[model samples]
Target: MTMRTFASMAKPGVTSALPLKEIPGSYGLPLVDSLVDRFDYFVTEGAENFFKTRIQKYKSTVLRVNMPPGPPIVSDPRVIMLLDAKTFPTLFDLTKVDKRDVLTGAYMPSTDFTGGYRTAVYQDPSEKTHGKLKAFCFEVLKMSRPRIFPEFTKAFDELSVEVEKEFENEGKASFSDKVDDLIFNFLCRALIGADPVAPGPASLGNSGPTHLKTWLAPQLAPIASSGILPKVLDELTIHTITLPFALVSRDYKKLYDFVDTRGSALLDVAQNEMGLQRDEACHDLLFHIGFNAFGGMFILFPSIVKYIAKAGQDLQREIAKEVRGAVEANGGLNMKALESMPLLRSVVYEVLRMDPPVPLQYARARKDFMVESYDAQYEIKEGELLGGYQPLATKDSHVFANAEEFVPGRFLGEEGEKLLEYVLWSNGRETDESTVDNKQCAGKDIVPMVARLLVAHLFLRYDSFAVDESSSSAIFTQLTKAS
Candidate 1:
């Protein structure tokens, strides 16, 4: 659907000239209301339905709602929910939105989680340290560019050997553990300038992802609801309560020391050239890779596998033919090869569109401004927390033709590529470039590049693979004969 066509989908004649209305919905009573909303959010309605029910009830896309972990944990549980493509981008405007402590929306994780320093993700563009740290992150990526392909390929080769050995010995391969190890090794080698397992006092070996996960979980416990336990119990324990950083302190220190010692090269640049303190730079580096980049792929890689596996054999054969042909035609599996493989790129994009690793994005309003939804305008006051559930926004029927179905070629050609601007998984549109000035993920381009590489390598090694998600966790249930 075209932009004009989607604009027509809005309420007829609800133009920019329409008078602003008070944002709909309410926070209700203090504790009682927040508890009820938290229960409904994590237990009854689920994340999507929680917003969906409200949107239907208010008959509007933008409304006031209580985000989870109210009261003692989050000073203010109320936030302005932006649920449509039209209004969601407002959160990305750094000039108007203060991205200070809204990383997880209202609940700021203790700085103890990152060695007593706020990471780049938590800092707004307006902060001077934010620029330095963000620039350092970009430089890390730039310096690591030459290493990414080689390290990723080596790690993937090792991963493939394990997957094959498991499948040969047993009838299937459990990919999650193997994939996690691959991600940590590749990221550490590429970004940190040393192999994680190489002989050293600080060698993490295969436990790097675990260290990162342990540090990440408690900090996010206040907002995390994976349905790991029964509803009532899960709500009380996981969602409403704040998890202490003390639990992960030892593990976090291991990560801190490893980065500080092993990644001294990058830290030296941060201190000597970039004018950042070494200790602060170490914490920021660990958070950037360990939490943001490593943590991201830790969720995303499996998702890509799950989607491709569900697409069945035909899509696999098509991807295999396309990827192999592109590599052969371009003379190697490099950037040129990736560019030639439109279908491969689209498949990754489709997975991202369907299941973004980071589902929510939040920013506090900097000043009073008018926010427009698909149909109406609402006046937002300064410092009001503005958030969006991107999974719902990307699937808005107004902007996308099939919004729900996984069409592998949805982002194939020039026309198809236009749809990418609405893909906001990286804290910004895929069409937008990431720079030190914005909150866009530093590894935005690197992420999909590595993902594309992983997918390409898999098809090249095997004709196809299948997954069995029927079990408690998704696993590689089978694979066709290796090519």
Candidate 2:
């Protein structure tokens, strides 16, 4: 697999909707605010290049290169930098093209994030990029279906009870809203197993961790994405040099405190429920269901809902295929019941492929590496870094054939295995080009399991809509209806 170039994506109408990569709100936010612009460009243009393994231009942005692309390693630390003397030129040097770091402008959160919600662009060694992505897709994605409506919405719970404990009036006020209640309901059940005020599942009375997890996600978002803003960072005059850092230190300590407190309870409940007998990454029904369903899950729900809604009739039909079959035979649904639906599984996979919650990954370059096949030097020198995007890779015509068409069987049939390895979340086998193993589902055969089951149950048995990208721009509504 040679390095994929975005130019290859120019297959017909490949880049026609490429501009969507520019703004977060789809049609809004027209300017490049910061380093994120570079990533948008890569995805827009390089999306087609994902077909092969090489990275290519996705879109050309107004956010031009102020400094030439530098070693990929230096930019890796671009996450939390003090834009002082060192940061000024260092950022420039990091962007210099001379360095192995394919500096464009893509990043994934590194501070402390769970799951695969952060996005970034990475410099790559062509084929290896594909391999690394295969490993990720398998490992991260769920094996089953989503927790669909009816059952998901049925079991009632006094939602946001724990959070209500934290902010008091604030929590009550916020939770009163429909969407807020929905997010809280999904999270509460997923976390404690019982929705205290609502229904069953039994609870361990663990509110400490539950509440902390609630506030942690949004609180950390601002710092991670835009870090202490320019004014805040600049406020620290000479005398306060160590002061802000001290406050930050305190905040850091608080995070540990919160994690330890909440994580401990979660660990116990999660371990007990899963009947864990060995050391694992805490990925059981408790953690998996809780984290994605409740905990830190709200981040991407809005966008996903829109996408699903936009898919409209096609989405409904696909949902029916997965859900309908199960209802006709297996009665209702559970993890196993959802497994019967393949179309549901495939469609979910394609949805993720096109609009990954994180788009790209942020990993600093370990060292300057070369794309052995392309024979091009991709400097990953120390202090430099790179990010890899699955969107650009998945949309590549070179790999996906039609590329943009949402053909459900796009990943099915003969070449299924080949595309499977292309997913950014999974642990598939490694193989060289030519006689490469086409491990269908790219090892991410699992990620969609829960969602599949949940959706299948809804599509087949209950009444609910799909989560396509075309729903509505109001990302928040997706969260609102989960209840």
Candidate 3:
């Protein structure tokens, strides 16, 4: 529980150096070690197996592995990965580690996506700018909270019809692709206070939602396929490569224009009320609503639906009953009704624990610090990059019984409340509060509401559902209505 500092542990002026062993891990080769191997393992073995394999091999919760080197590419060549739930809390302590170094890790593009690091995601806790931006985000979310259920309900109705049409025509509906558009439109309506579609004619090509996805996919593609571009080239030309797309790509241009026009009122609130510049406010909105919130929802909603389907009919019936009862008792699918469903909350937490969209977290040590594992303590030096693989930590056998299996009501009661801290899927600990200085997700409170609404709508409309599990995609089929 206590941190052993060098000055405190050593005699004064002697500059005592504690023998810090590199957490046991294979760096592979010179320069290009383990990067491809790690990426392949993640994609093939799945995130759970990827971390489990390494933890078993190293026999330690902490490890140092060589990643594709550079600032904007990977955090560092020798990155430390923490796997134990006991050690997970250290990753959230911003007093010891600096999050601003590379919040997105090495794959984060060097484009001015935030209008010159003006967004809360890119700022350190100590910066005044972070506080202002954080306040702006919180205020916007407060205003939008009342609208989340209604907005998401509308989107889900549209999505349900779309799915039914596809199933009627083709015998199966690709829920993965359909959910992306559904969540994107829902997030836009709730967060940006704008319509999710472009203002112009349908003949003008793809809608605003399509354009937004087209632009974001390539930027995020590097994470799955590392080493796509050399570190040196990425450093020099990332902004050059990214900036021009906005100017040249018709889809990017249309998306940008639509967001700017539709989100002008929100931007003005940030500028006039919150003290941000017009352009900075616009860019921040895009980063917050488009990238952060949209990316998380895109993966989360589908995962929730897939798991519920996999959980079988009895559990699905229970969830549907809870949703129906809550709506009837409350007179509608409001935030209060969603919050009242303990079983739904447990299901969402379990889904996040098992398959977090963002499995890895990256931070840099601001100063020399000490971290302890289940067995031993290690000294981490300044500038060293640290990572926490969430799936492994959340599923630690020491914490959860039957760690690998999905239990639908695992977190339903007061006893389950204590286990909430182990849910590290949101880029921050469940116990951690979102603040200007901390790295907890700004949308942490809203994400659950969004997920609950999606679940409520799905169960309300369909009595039971089945998924096409043969492929990686989560397609829907065999939808049955209530008897």
* Model 3 stretches with alpha carbons more than 4 Å out: 1-22, 26-28, 34-47, 68-75, 112-118, 198-206, 225-250
Model 3 agreement with the true structure over 212-314: per-residue lDDT tens digits: 6666755654444333465444334542233434442566555556567777777788888989777766677677877788878888888888999889999
Per residue, candidate 2 scores C-alpha lDDT tens digits across 1-483 of: 222333223232332222222211111232222223323323232332322222213122111121111123122223211111111112212222122223233322232332222111222323333333333323323221243334354532333233234335342222222333455454444432335333222222334234434434332332132223443332222111212223233333433333334344544533464443212223222233333344323433343344455666566666665576676677656555666766666766666656654443333334333211111112224433433444554565545777766666555666764675554432121122211122223223333553454345334332334332332332222221222
Which candidate has the top score in TM-score? 1
Candidate 2 residue-wise lDDT at 28: 20
The digit string of per-residue lDDT tens for model 1 on 263-298 reads: 988999999999999999999998888878888898
lDDT of 2: 0.35
Candidate 2: residue 263 lDDT (0-100): 40
TM-score per prediction, in order, is: 0.94, 0.48, 0.87
The better-scoring model by TM-score among 1 and 3 is: 1
Q: Lowest lDDT 10-mer window, candidate 1?
A: 2-11
Ranking by TM-score: 1, 3, 2
Candidate 3 — what's its lDDT? Answer: 0.72
